[model samples]
Target: MATPTRPGNYREQAKTYDLTRGASPTIVRAVAEHLGEPRGRTLLDIAGGTGNYAQVFATRGFRVTVVDAQLAMLEHSARKLGGGHAVAGAAAHLPFSDGSFDCATLVHAVHLLQDPSPALREAHRVLREGPLVAVDPTRENAPLFVHEYFGLHPPDDARPSAEDIALLLRRAGFATVEHHPFVYTDTADGSLHALHTNALHLAGPAYLRNTSFWYGLDEEARRAGLDALARDLRSGRLEERVRAHYLEAAVRGHETVFAAWP
Candidate 1:
């Protein structure tokens, strides 16, 4: 199997990954609730960068295991969450016994994966009996604010659409497959400097943490786009609502929170 590589992948962008994360308490809570019952169940957070979801699970009484390909991400997650509670591995081949976890989570990062299909298969092997919640970008289903400014569409590659994901889940032998749409909304209460900084952070780190399309862009293109965005922001051409959308999935109006499970 071939592992994909990008110039400024998670290994390099782990530092700033969570600095401007769009997740708020509301969003996290929604995800937690979507996870079904969290009590006394073990979880496998595949490609669980920086333990954001794992941290939430741990507090909710679910014994959590965060697996990622980058040691740096797990290490940073440890520091931020105050414990070394993650493993370094690929989703295609998780290092665990059969039926090891009660549930598995493949968040937004799956689209960037080298082999998402095999990863879903691995999740099936590891889960004892519970739902595997796979979240992908809800961009296609919603209007985007980021698109208006940067035209930041994810490049054509291995990223799967919602329909494709459902097919994959069924192909992977998941039972009772279901799709749930969640919306995460965050509002900033008059913080100009913070808003400006967040605007740049949304583009990428290097131009990113996840959502590799920004990283995939040429350096010149990313720089030019950021400059124009800054100009609009400072000139009042860009409003606070626009900045809020950038902070999330680049859809200024709404962020698509698509979750699939079985």
Candidate 2:
């Protein structure tokens, strides 16, 4: 039998995935604000591909671990971390002991899991009385229909909503949690450019999945779809302004002066 696809398989398209979702550094700052000062804190960033947000805490003097199942992505993140530990591990089974760190974070990678409950539970067990942050691209904020039209639903189908996410974290032992919406804006022109870049990156898989139906006219149809999408984007019919919701919850058990804890 074929090897089942795991979270790390996503590394095959890590570059595009990061570009598509990595903008908006504000979200990371907000998470930091919640986690508070990093003095004497240790952080475990689960499935933290390329360590985009992990660096935030690491720079603040916290010992950071960037864990992912993908060697390629872990390698990429290691270059940025510069001697910081980058471990090749699965989120569902983090290679750590209980209360191993001051805090933990899972950014933009939750929805990709086949089972998130185990990972959340692991995060809870590994934290030393601090928050376990989980974040993802909200459905409302994603380029839903456009991506679907292009047969890019494999990843989309993996994403979960805010409500479901909160429930999962609570079950995993997070005492208290809060959900917030993060808004992303893009003008029609800008949105179109972003979409084109995305489509091009997804073209290989999308062509095989979608163009199969238009085999006799695959090339022509593909070009036409691109043209039509561009026209729609330029004509303001594509709904360029995108808004995505993110969740930031502080697990209740730990109490610090002010909601922000070190």
Candidate 3:
């Protein structure tokens, strides 16, 4: 049988996924603020991975519906956040009525797609003429320590750019698309061992599996990259600054907004 087309390696990572990833209050607030008031609005969080992003809007009285291909992730979201409609579906084929939502969000989930067009179209189709906000890290602003360990370049085309995101939105028939560039910088806490743990959360399939970054490398490269990260952490050669470059979209005027991508 052929391997199924999926977004991320959540099935294996579900047990420790939340521990690997973080709770970025700044990111959550920014995404929610861009969408304006949420008193009675409805949102579709596509591939929402545990509903961390959805909770921000949901707490403010927005009716949030989360959909992901991973049942483990949906169960996790339910366990943590407690009250959102959870669905099992692919982003390319959302099991939603046309114009069913006031707006939609994709919290760093877009780049995980094997093809972006179909998901973008589906997002556009589900919203009631509102914005479909997305967020993700730009190659330029990625943390140097992590990127260098992985042997990635400054202009790596592996990840989508803000411009590419806007073009994708435009291609999906969004009339007005705006890119908002933001920077999220932080550092690891605790000893070298803690740094190693934190780094593992961001990379490697067995750990976080949040992104396909580690999966893109060869076995040799992957092992070497991770080893180097550990060595640098232990020896105190690394600065430990996580300079995450982020792009947030404000689409379709003052109504809807793009959420995020990983």
Candidate 4:
């Protein structure tokens, strides 16, 4: 089974991170709504790379402070949102006092941690009776093309489901927990042509360098996967396989938000 590259491995990808990953307005609204009206309250964005979500949250009236382990990523966040707001710290060891934040958010960051319990506990400790919203990818809803082409499969032991995360939240001292599952279908073109284009893009050198799946693969495996994808595309077999995968409902991707309160 394939696992995501460690958080420390993200340093080189920080320069082009914003190009492929940006804050979605829809996700921002969902997280903000769960966090409640900002009311000028302080928000701590844990593992917030480049301050993408932090920037949006600040505009929504939350005094945002972004904490990331990577100095390279923190540098970008500092540049985007001015200096003091970006702090160099680990999620499990946040440099803040107890009950320092009105709310907290972990956006697409749980997978990076080897163990998320400590981080959840830290979040609960720093929050003052407010929500700690976490957005995590649902492995069950991962697109099949990801596994078929990249050979990346997140084992259940490594990637927790929504229910598993809720249990962790409870163990971390959260009293109430709510799950909100959402599918990212707005960009799904639902056609063979769209699948073809997406496959080519995923197999491209730029994606190989930046994406976690490609980063996790060894050099020989990466080369083999790329070569196989190229041959399939040339032989027109890629479209056929993708169409069948879509029919089996393997092309859809979704995520879940776990809102926990202390």
Candidate 5:
């Protein structure tokens, strides 16, 4: 997914970013657990749109600062944080002094960076001997139904794998790097119908519009894919197809959290 270079690119999407792209509690728990006790330590959440993850960390007693390039996103983040720190800044050029934060998190936002190396180095610069935890969906995973339905296959050149992120951290002067692969399985009752319904819900318009995958597709492809999906949904074939897809791959996908010690 390409990162939007300007604030205007996210103006429209920022309004409903939280409604459609809320933080996954499971992922939030994993991030918190990895970071360990906050003990009133400060955390810098880079590219933290809407502060979804940052607010959760704040509740756990971490002094969280959410930084994003888009003012619109930071506006939502500011509201969610309730007078907490939310700054408009770029990842590579964070407006903070060295060793400012105790720990840092970059959840599902690394791919949005046009160039990740400088940002990773900057993260290393601002952190004071703490782990930088980054969470992202790796390329080495089962294809998501949303991607397949929308004809949104991420180009290998653009998508960074878990290994790539670890390598970047190491290059940025992190001493140790560990990868924890997380798979979010369906928790619904073990029924084909339920599974199909769950998959269908994920492919809905609200959810689709929020994903980077949907924006990656061309106008022609978007129209064609939507038409095909609509046809399937109307004809009752969507359930059957969704069931078959899940039967082939029971797990949702592989999202890895890379913890790098500075």
Candidate 6:
């Protein structure tokens, strides 16, 4: 199988993506409820993988436009969200006019962007007067137990800290950019924790199957990594603790809106 190099091609791995990395629907509902009514506003789900967020908006009676750079991702989103409208476009170059949407969001795909500012600007440009939300797991609050088990290190990408995200919103013409910490937690002995650990164990191999770019591991290092994670899981090292912090920004402009991009 050919390796998928772009985010759009993620559709080829969409099923696995959902199985391994899908967010809890309960959490989604909880978070969305905090943002208040979707009513009849139009929402632009930027870099919306598989249309998870877009569908959430739709279910709340909001008109949704799902945008992603990857065609495969858009296809998957369309399929999941009832063949709804989607745009094959980059976050930095949205094909909409100024003040086109009431809300904008980017979920978990910012680190992959070569330039996040332009995407931020595009999001601001497309919104009439609404909040731009970014929902991502913060480095400060990411699950630490899995880091050791998976050989995961700190992020190498340039990310705006939660504070920096609010500053960016202000710079992008949002009037009252505010942040709320959206946290996720599961205790050591909880079923949620077990499921997460098992999923993490499979995620790397699943990603490798789609693309074996694990630094040319020569099969030895690859096996070793998996073995290490497995050992940690069985010995209880993998269940130390789990928590994720999401940053939500309310951008000020034409109309009030709330969004979480992480």
**Best model number under lDDT:** 4
Candidate 3, residue 202: lDDT: 38
Off by over 4 Å in 1: 1-3, 6-8, 80-84, 143-159, 187-211, 240-262
- Best to worst by TM-score, what's the order? 5, 4, 1, 3, 6, 2
Worst 10 residues of 1 by lDDT: 187-196
Off by over 4 Å in 4: 1-8, 151-158, 185-200, 231-253
- What is the C-alpha local distance difference test score of candidate 5? 0.73
lDDT of 4 by residue, 3-60 (tens): 6447436788787776656676556766877999888999999999788889888888
* Residues 149-223 of candidate 3: C-alpha lDDT, one tens digit per residue: 768665556656667777788888777776665433321211111223244343443442344454456778778
User: What are the lDDT scores of the predictions, listed in order?
Assistant: 0.62, 0.57, 0.62, 0.74, 0.73, 0.57
Better of 2 and 4 by TM-score: 4
Model with the higher TM-score, candidate 3 or 4: 4
Poorest stretch of ten by lDDT in candidate 5:
187-196
74 Cα displacement, candidate 6 (Å): 1.0
Report, for all candidates in order, the number of backbone clashes.
7, 0, 14, 0, 0, 15
lDDT of 4 at 102: 91
Candidate order by decreasing lDDT: 4, 5, 3, 1, 2, 6
Task: Write one digit per residue (lDDT tens) for candidate 6, span 1-262.
Answer: 9854543336465545555445445345434654557878888889887677677678878788899887866787888676547888988899888888887777666655655678888888898756666665343332323334335464634334666666666676667765554333321111122234234443345544332124334466667777776665566654443211111111111011235332
Colliding pairs, model 1: 144-251, 145-251, 145-252, 146-250, 204-207, 204-208, 205-208
User: Which portions of model 6 miss their true places by more than 4 Å?
Assistant: 1-12, 26-34, 142-145, 150-152, 155-159, 185-221, 241-262
Regions of model 2 farther than 4 Å from truth? 1-3, 14-23, 138-143, 151-159, 185-225, 234-236, 239-262
As for model 5, its CA RMSD to the true structure in angstroms is 4.7
- The pairs that clash in candidate 5 are none
Q: What tens digits encode model 2's per-residue C-alpha lDDT throughout 157-250?
A: 4445666777788888888787665432221111221233233322333322221122323465557655666665566554432111011111
Q: For candidate 4, give the lDDT of residue 225.
A: 78
